[model samples]
Target: MLLATINSSIVLISLPAIFRGIHLDPLEPGNVSYLLWMIMGFLVVSAVLVVLLGRLGDIYGRVRMYNLGFLVFALSSVLLSVDPFDQGAGAMWLIVLRVVQGVGGAMIFANSAAILTDAFPAHQRGMALGINNVAAVAGSFLGLVIGGLVAEWDWRAVFWISVPIAIAGTVWGYRSLHELGSRRTSSMDWWGNLTFAVGLTALLVAITYGIQPYGDHATGWTNPWVVAGLVGGIGLLIAFVLVEQRVEDPMFSMHLFAIRPFAAGNLASLLAATSRGGLQFMLIIWLQGIWLPLHGYDYESTPLWAGIYLLPLTVGFLVAGPVAGRLSDRYGARLFATVGLVLVAGTFIGFLLIPVDFDYWVFALLLLVNGLASGLFAAPNATMIMNSVPADQRGAASGMRGTFMNSGSALSIGLFFSLMVAGLASSLPGSLRSGLTAQGVPSDVAGQVADLPPVGSLFASFLGYNPIQTLLEPTGTLDSLSADHATTLTGKTFFPQLISGPFHDGLVVVFLAAAVMSLIAAAASALGGAKYVHQED
Candidate 1:
């Protein structure tokens, strides 16, 4: 579980190196979509399939499915590590392998808790779950550090590093982990699976594409394909619900929502996850794009430093996760879960107060506080949900839980990026035009260039590329500028300096939106009320 979780997170930190290694600019027009999809496709696929795969575990054996997951995951890691293509082909291969890896991830995610539930008694379940959940959450932040380190040496090393660990985990789990849970002897819920998978895949794909510019607009929301995907996906999901209700053995047990604890816990989890999912990416971009660049770090080195700077956040999570879990085991989960979310909301507010170029110590401390709050919320909330289900339903329940969490993550990515892009769109062009014109660029050229979609700036910042160079290249303006002027324009200092104000303005919107969502999540957590520990009927 630790190894799998770590690998899942490590990719985010390595993205810059990976893009460079593949000789692709993540910020290139039309390329941002691919970059976003590559980063997010693993999560989307995992979210969509977890429920279906979890039901499979219920029918088949959880241990067998989990073991298979390890093998598939390991194989995909090998494929990603040894990717032979360069440029677009390489990016495609990575995305494809990542999707395959998500399949493996779904198996592990769906079964891990059910396996633990089968092994641990009810009283000890909270403690065990807390440890597992903490590892999973911590692994994400840990991935940032590991990815930075490995990617510094070689981008492929990020994927390579996972292989041996996965092999060991596969062997260990196969040898030691036994199937102790009840298995249902029922047919697969084929219709439910098909509808749910297709619907979710379409919706997430739409969201992924919607973050990219389309037909001269700042975003793709108005694109016919995106609109169709969103609408069509929702329709299918609605149909899936109807199918599940009619089916004897459903992929996701609709009746599970009847339990107040399960229903409310899942809702709160979705809300919390939605609020939290895109946060790490946003923070990473903020650090790498604006803060690090301003603080004497080269754009190329920003990715690595961003990871290092954020270490305090991980520290907080490591400190708080197990401790909160243990406390929740003794007391009910409500106090911890509710308080944790409130703290998260406070952290968002704290973020809003910090200037874009604030001191490192202040940013680090705030991140640590945020991590602590997240850790406090994660374990207890998860335990509450898991404990509410029947023994035989644990696999499916875990899958449903994962589906909501991962889907929230996907949705959050879309929402955060959309909001940030919108905010940037409003202010960035004017800033760019003014800044470029001040540097003696022709007003007409600058105006045309500024009018380009703000998604470009977001992607440029994310990829550690100099936006000025990208902007000037197509216009033949770079060749026209004097040596000194061109040098100044393309230099590390100019682009970041130019974009800071507009970026901060955009970030305010994103952060405040996150803060609002976090508040709603806190309210949902409060509504979930006390944790209910279940026994066999």
Candidate 2:
């Protein structure tokens, strides 16, 4: 489980190096979408399939499916490590393999909780789950450090690093992890599977496309295809719910939600995930784009530095996770879960207080607090949800929990990016116009250039490209500027300096949204009540 968690996070830190290795620019207009998808596609696919796979595990054998997951995950890692193509083709290959990897991940994610629940006695389940849940969250933060280190040395090493660990896990799981749960001889829920998959895939695709520009607008939300996806997918889901109510064996057992703890725990998990998942990316951008650049780090070095600077977050999680889990085992989850969310809300406010280029020590301390808050919430919430389900139903319930969590993460990426980009679009052009006009450029050209879509600028900063070069290259005005003026215009420092005001505006909006969501999550967690259900001995 630890190794799996490690692999999940390690990729995030190594993305810049990975792009360089494939002879691709992460900021190139055509590649920006690919880069975002590559980072997120594995998560999306895993979120969508876990429920189906979990149901399969219940019908077949948990150990059998889990062992197979290790094998598949290992094979995909090898494929990813030895990626043969260069340029766009290589990037495409990586995306495809990543989806395959998600398959393995789904199997593992779907069953790990059920396997643990089967192995641990009821009294010890919280501690065991706490350790497991912490590994998952810890992996997310640790990925930054590992990614930064491995990517700095060699990008392929990041993927290769997973190979040996995966091999060992596969062997160990097969030999030692036994099937302790009963298998149901139920038929597969084909209708439930089809509707759920198609519905979810459509909705996620709509969200993904929503972040890209559509026609003259900065976002694709109004596009016919995107609207269709959103509407059609939702319609299918509505139909799926109706179908599930009638099915003899439904993929998502709707009745499960009738249990207060299970339902409330999942709702809180989704909201918490939505608030937190997208935050990591926003924080990375905040560090890499504004803070690191202003603090003397070159754009090329910002990715690694951002990861390094964020180490305190991982430390906080490590400190809080197991202890919270142990405490929850003795006391009910309501107190810890509610308090943890309150702390998370506090962390968001803390983030709002600091300037983008604030002192590192202060920033790190806030991040540590955030991590601790999240750790406090995670284990107990997960334990509460799993405890409420029947032992045979744990796999499906866990998968459902994962789906909500990962989907919220994916959705958060879209929501935060959209909000930030919209904020950028509103203020960036005017800021750019003023800055360029001050530098003696013509008002007409400056205004025309400023009015260009903000997506390019957002992508430029995101991929560590110099936004000024991209902004100026298309106008053909760079050739006309004197060498000194052109240097000033295209230098690394120019665009970050220009867009800081607008960027901060967008960041505040994102933070506020996250804070509100966290508060809601805290409320929901509290509503889950004090009841704990343990299957009869």
lDDT of candidates 1 onward, in order: 0.84, 0.84
How displaced is residue 428 in candidate 2, in Å? 0.8
Which ranges in model 2 have alpha carbons more than 4 Å from their true place?
440-445, 474-480, 490-492
Candidate 1 lDDT over 224-272, as tens digits, reads 9999999999999999999999998888888888887788778888878
Candidate 2 per-residue lDDT, tens place, 140-171, comes to 77777777778878888988887897899899
TM-score of each: 0.97, 0.96
Please give the lDDT score at residue 115 for candidate 2: 87
Candidate 2 vs. true structure, TM-score: 0.96
Provide the lowest-lDDT 10-residue window in model 2: 458-467
